[model samples]
Target chain A: MTINFDNAATTFPKPVSVANAIFKAVKQYGGNAGRGGHKLTLLTSEKVFDTRQTAADFFGAQTENVIFTVNCTHALNFAIQGIMSNGGHIIISGIEHNSSARPVYALAKKKKCTFSIAEVSDDPDETVNNFRSLINHNTKAIVCTIAGNVTGQIMPYKEIGKLCQEKNICFIADGAQACGTLDIKMSDGINILCTAGHKGLYGPTGTGLLISDGKYHITPLIQGGTGSSSLNLEHPDILPDGMESGTLNVIGIIALKNGIEFVRDMGTAKIFKHEDKLCRQFINGLSDTRTIIYRSPGVEYVPIVSFNIPDMKPEDVAEKLDQQGFCLRAGLHCSPLAHYSMGTTDGTVRFAPSVFNNENQVESLVKTIKKIQKI
Target chain B: MNMTAVSMPSVTLAIKAKRMLNEQGFKCTVKRAANVSENGCTHMIVVNGAPEIVIAFLDKYNIAYGKLLGDAMPQ
Candidate 1:
C-alpha cells in the first residue's frame, strides 16, 4: 500500500477511536440535535453539547461559543463575512489560503468592504508591523492563517492577536494547519479561531469548528430552524444556534469528539515532535543538490515541506512519486497567495507528514525522488 | 407537590441550567415548556427546590431565562 503524506490536506487512517465513534454515531446518534425534545433528539443534542464542551475546553472557550461547521472553509466564510458585514477595512496575511481570501475578495468586490494584504516576513515582528501599518480608523478585523498551508511557515498569530487586542480590532485566525500540532487557545489573544477537524485532529471529513471568545457579535450567515424561538419569523439571537442554523452534523461531530480526544491523549507537543522529526529526516535525506526545498533557515514551520525539481513539472514529479507508492500533493494546494508569497508561482510538490509517518517512509520517499530526478 | 419551572430560551440553555442545578443537589429535570407564547416554543428546567434559591442560582450564573413559573410559593 502507498504511504499517505498529504496530511496537510486531510489526515488519512484516522484513529481507531475516531472510527469507532463514527460507527457508534451512525448507528445511535442519528437524531437531529436541538430539533426536538424527543428522547432521541435530546440524547443527540446532549452528545453534541458534549463535543462542543470538549472543543471549548480544548480551545479555552465557552461551550456556547463553539460552532460546528461543514469544513474550515465554511467557518472562515462565517467569520470573515460576518466581521466584514458593516463595510470597513480589513487586513489579511499574504500567505492566506483561498478559504479566507475568497470570502474577503467577494466582500470587496461587492464594495461591502475593503482589504489590504500584510506582507509576511521571516521576522515575526516585521510581519506584525506590516499588519499594523495597514490598519486605519475603519479597520474592523485582521484575518490570518496560523500557518501557511503550502510552505508550512508558522505565522506570528499570537503576536498578531496581541496587536489586534491592543488596537481593539477583532482577530480571526484560520487554524486549519496548526490546530492538532500546535498548542493554541482562545486566551492566546484570538477572538475567533477556525479549524478543520479532519486534518491534525484526525476526524472524518465535513467536520470543522468555529470557536469564539464571545467578545464580538457575528451576524449569522444562514438563518433557519435553531430549535429556539420557533414562533417568530426573525432568527434567534442565541449563540451557536444563531450561527449554526439547520440540522447539526451529529455523526461527524460525535466522531470529532473522539478525534480530539485522540489528539489530546497523544498530546500536541508529542505529535509535533513526531511529525517534525519526519520532516527533518525528509529534508536531510534528500542528498541531491538539484532538489529545491522551499524553506528558510530561521523561520519555523509545521511538518510540511514544498519542493520542486529543476526542468520538471511538479505534476510529473508527483505522478512519478505516486507510481513509486508514495502520495504527495502537487500544484498550488488551493493557496495561490501562498505560492505568490513564497515565489513558487509555478507550484511545487508538498511533503506533509502526519503522526502516522516515520523515518523509514521519509527515507523511501527521498530515495524515490532521487530516482525520479534521473529521468 | 411544589415545583418551580424556569423557562429557557433554548434546549442548550435548559441543559446548562439542569446541569448547573443538579450539580448543586438542586435536583432538576428539563422538559418542553407547557405554555408556548406567540414568540415560540422553548425548554424549561423544572426543579423541586425553593424558587428563590433556584432564581438566585440562575441569576448568579447569569444564565438567561424567559420566565419563572411555579405551582406553589414559599409564602
Candidate 2:
C-alpha cells in the first residue's frame, strides 16, 4: 500500500464525518448562506453561522470576529492588507512563509510599507528579545507564524504578542501549521489569527478562517453583496458581513464544522501525540545515518520533518521515494525565506504526517530512505 | 407556524437577532417587512412563541425591536 506523507499541504483520508458532511451539505443543504428568506437559505445560514461560533470558540475569540476566507493565504492577505492600509512598518521572523513574506514584499514594492526580519534564535528568550529590539514607533503590525512551516520551529509568539499589546501593535499570526496541533488563545495578545482549514482543521481545500479581536478595523479586501444590505449599495459595517463578500463556500463551510467536530472529539492532544511519536521515531531511526541531514528538536507538536541526503538533491530523493510507492514533498515548500534560514538554500524533502498516518507507515518510510542511501 | 415580527434597525441586525434567538431554542426566520415604511428597514425577523417571551429575551440581550404583530404582513 502507498503511504501519503504530504499532509502539511492538506490532510488525506479525512474523517468519515467530514466527508459525509460535505456530501450531505451539497446534496441536502444546497442554498446560499445569508441570501434569502426561504427555508433552505435560512437553515443553511443558521448552520454556517453556528460554524462561526464554533470556530470562534475554538480560536478563543467572540463569534462575530471569526470570518471565513478561501484559504489561509486569503485570510492573511485580508489581515495584512486590511490593517496596513495607511502603510507603515512591520516586523517578521526569519522563518516566515511566503504567505506573509510575499505579501510584505509586494506591499514594499508598491511603496506601501517597510518591514524588518528579526533573527530567529534557538533560545526562546533571545528570539523574543530580537523581536523586542526590532520594534519601533513606525511598527504597525507584527505578522509572524505560530510555527515555522518548513522546520516546525515554534516561535515564542505569545511573548511577541504581549510586546504588541504593550506597544499597541497588531499581532497577526499565521496559524496554518499550528492551529490544530497547538492551542492559540486570543488572550495571548494575537489581534488577528489566520489559518487554513485543510492543514490542521481537517476542512475542505476552499475553507479557512480569520479570527480577529474587535480592536482595530481591517478594510475589506473586496466589496459586493453581503445579503444583508441589499437595498443599499454600501457594505454593512458589521463583521463577517463586512469582510465576507459574495456567496461564501457554504458546502465547504458545512463540511468544516464536521471536521472541527472530528478534531474536537479525537482531542488535539491525542492526535499530536500520535503524529509526534511517528516524527520522533523517524528522527531516531535516522540518527545513525551519517549522510542524512535534518532540522532538530524532532519531538515537536507539529509533525513536519525537513531533511536531505548528502551529495543528493532533494528532488532526486523524492522522485526515487515516489517510485518506491511513498509520497513525500520536495523542494522549497513555498517558503524560500524558511529555506534560507534553515541553511537549506537548495531546499529539503518535507514529510508532514497526519493523525491518520501510523507507525508502520513511518517505519516503511525510514526503511525506504535507508535502502535509497545504499544504492 | 404563525409568527410575530421583530424589527431591528438594520437587516443584518435582524438576521443576527434571529440566529441569537434560534440559538436559544426559538425558531425564527427572516421576512420582508409587511409594509415598506420610509424609516424602517425592508426586512424583519419572525420569531415563534409568545410575544412576551420575545420581548423579555430581546430586552435581556438589549436588542431593540418593535412590538409584535401577527404572522400576516400589512398590505
Clashing pairs in 1: none
Report model 2's TM-score to 2 decimal places: 0.91
TM-score of chain A of each: 0.99, 0.97
Candidate 1 lDDT tens digits, A1-375: 699999999998899999999899889987888876678888888898888888998999888889999999999999999888788999999999999998999999999999999999999999999999999999999999999998999999999999999999999999999999999999999999999999999999999999999998898989999887888889987887889998888899999999998898899999999999999888887744589999999999998999999999999999999998899999999999888877788899999999988888888888889888762
Interface RMSD of 1: 1.5
Candidate 2 lDDT tens digits, A321-368? 999888889999889887787788888998889988988889888988
Where does model 1 sit among the CAPRI classes?
A: medium
lDDT of candidate model 1 versus the reference? 0.89
Provide the TM-score of chain B versus the true chain B for each model in turn.
0.82, 0.75
Q: Write the per-residue lDDT of candidate 1 for residues B2-71, one digit (tens) a residue.
A: 5788788877778888888888988788777634534677777889786788888989997888877653
In angstroms, how far off is A305's CA in candidate 2? 1.0
The C-alpha RMSD in Å for every predicted model, in order, reads 2.1, 3.2
